[model samples]
Target: MDEVLIVVGPDVVADAGLIEEIAGREFAALGVRGSVTHARDAAHAAELLRDGAVVIPGRSGEMRELIGRAAGAVVWVDVERVDGVEPGEGATHLHGRGLGGIAWGIRHAAHRMRHPGRRRIPYGPHRDQWGDLYTPADSAPVVALIHGGYWRSIWAADLMEALCADLLARGLAVWNLEYRRPDLHGWEATTADVAAGLAALGDAGKVAVVGHSAGAQLAFQAAADGARVTLAVSLAGVLDLVEGDRRWLSSGAVAAALGRRVPRGAQASHGRSPHADDETVRLYIAASPLLRLPLGVRQLVVQGSADDLDLVDFGRRYTQAARQAGDEVTYLEMPGDHFDVITPATPIWQATAEAIAGALA
Candidate 1:
């Protein structure tokens, strides 16, 4: 029987259904039967590779190991950039570098069900960095938590803790903060909540804000707006604003929030950005970290090649701009997708924990 075998690493639940469907269709199109099986690890894949099996594109240590181990025996495929997809496809149907696409759906739902919307929480500050204090003045550093979404009415501050739950073990307090969205108020309302929370904390140096996705951009904007931040981080922030603002303006939520259609054109869109409190023509340049620096804060930005949103090339482009402006910025790129840096039990999480620890220490 003419057939093709599909090999995949056991760790990739996100790609399972797509891989199977693709294999079956390809098999039929080629007049052959296609079967998919999990390799358990690279060792089994090594055997398949030895038999001239074609390697499916996915990135895991085992997949990479098998490819390097059998470069000649197998044909490597970038199944992600699948041969054909039509123009004007919705963003959800496409694949992003790391976990951008999958993470988006999972996160969008998670954020909506979890975060809700803008609300204020009490907090406190420590020594060194200048921020408000909520808890009694002591040596304990505040743990700043951030959430991710497209930054619209569809999501709020939910699920920020799951991927970043471990900062507590390192002697820091965590802050699960929120920002404005299409359903909420404007950017001013969101940042104002942040500003109020930080002020409540008391010591800016004792606080660290760890933010994800759209939350990252909000964090930087918050720090820049005189919030007295000690340390800040952005996890797959749509900081560049080029793509994000476009996407936001495209969404129905933006109109609902603004009470009008999102005016197109770069100048018009920038003017209507949720980053502001009102539809004022001013502060467009001052608001974006990419356009201007939110000075006096130490920052870290981590991205991955597999996740398109955090790709070093763009997405979070504001970090570099912030760095050039002489703000202390550290950039980290790793394997996996957008949420990869924040996912459970990885060096990314460990390193992030340590950075926050040191910043407060």
Candidate 2:
């Protein structure tokens, strides 16, 4: 008989039910009948995994110790912490490329990235801009990418071409997305472009999405499309709307794009914003994969340690919710910032490709 072990963090009151359910039900759903142990003590978990494969929702220091002792006992899922990189609130200066220039480069690179998605199939005169044929043909599996500028428009898609190329080599189609700035298009309109781009792709085979920073918010829509999406990868994904609402207000620059036209008299900053209309707030939460993750789709959240803008707990909360929602979730915690995962040549992309291929298979 095969076996699996699931370890949940000791939030005791909150995670108790989750631990029990995962230990019992999750593996059962995967068609494996085995003992599910929800152990608070990592030492005990290590002892148990010697019996069979293990599944852990979190890799705590204590759990790490136990796993290190008997790492072979577990088939641990990689969980990401929040990106520790503190992206500038506004346009930041680069040694050679200033903020606007960087933005311009991103827009241009997004334009040049268009190519055949696969070798055998012909990608069309697609409506979307960030089109690079991954398979040497067109429109195989559009990994439509959207960069995060905090809706600030400074961080464009220029820094991400490497990630796109890597996905293409892995035989996954790439769509490196660029959108109208908060200065020009506003958040709603920018997202509309995302919708349009996806629609333009015309329901290709299992569109798997990868979004970084603000794009992580957009990836939620791709995963939640409830379409034939295979998997959704969020690297330093911005999954919480409340956090975004506050950041938008504080940065002030995002008001141009994020539909954050501050109300004249509203003074509330915590819980929920007083100025945000029901629809707007709903939209923000809607874009959040954490709130909208579907049951069938697999989700991989890759976050960095000690990330500055997005908190680590935010990623933890997201994975926890997905587990509760009955979605297959894999989390990876690498040691890097928001840009680390997107560094095309980085091992992060390779790991991501492996995960994607596994999911697609």
**Which one is best on lDDT?**
2
Tell me each candidate's TM-score. Answer: 0.54, 0.57
Candidate 2, TM-score vs. the true structure? 0.57
lDDT of 1 by residue, 153-257 (tens): 334343454543355445455666644443445655555666665566565456777677667766777787776767878776656544344455335332343
RMSD in Å for all candidates: 15.8, 19.1
lDDT of 2 by residue, 223-250 (tens): 5765345677788877765554556533
Identify the leading candidate in terms of TM-score. Answer: 2
Q: How accurate is candidate 1 locally (lDDT)?
A: 0.53
User: Where does model 1 exceed 4 Å of error?
Assistant: 1-139, 246-283, 309-311
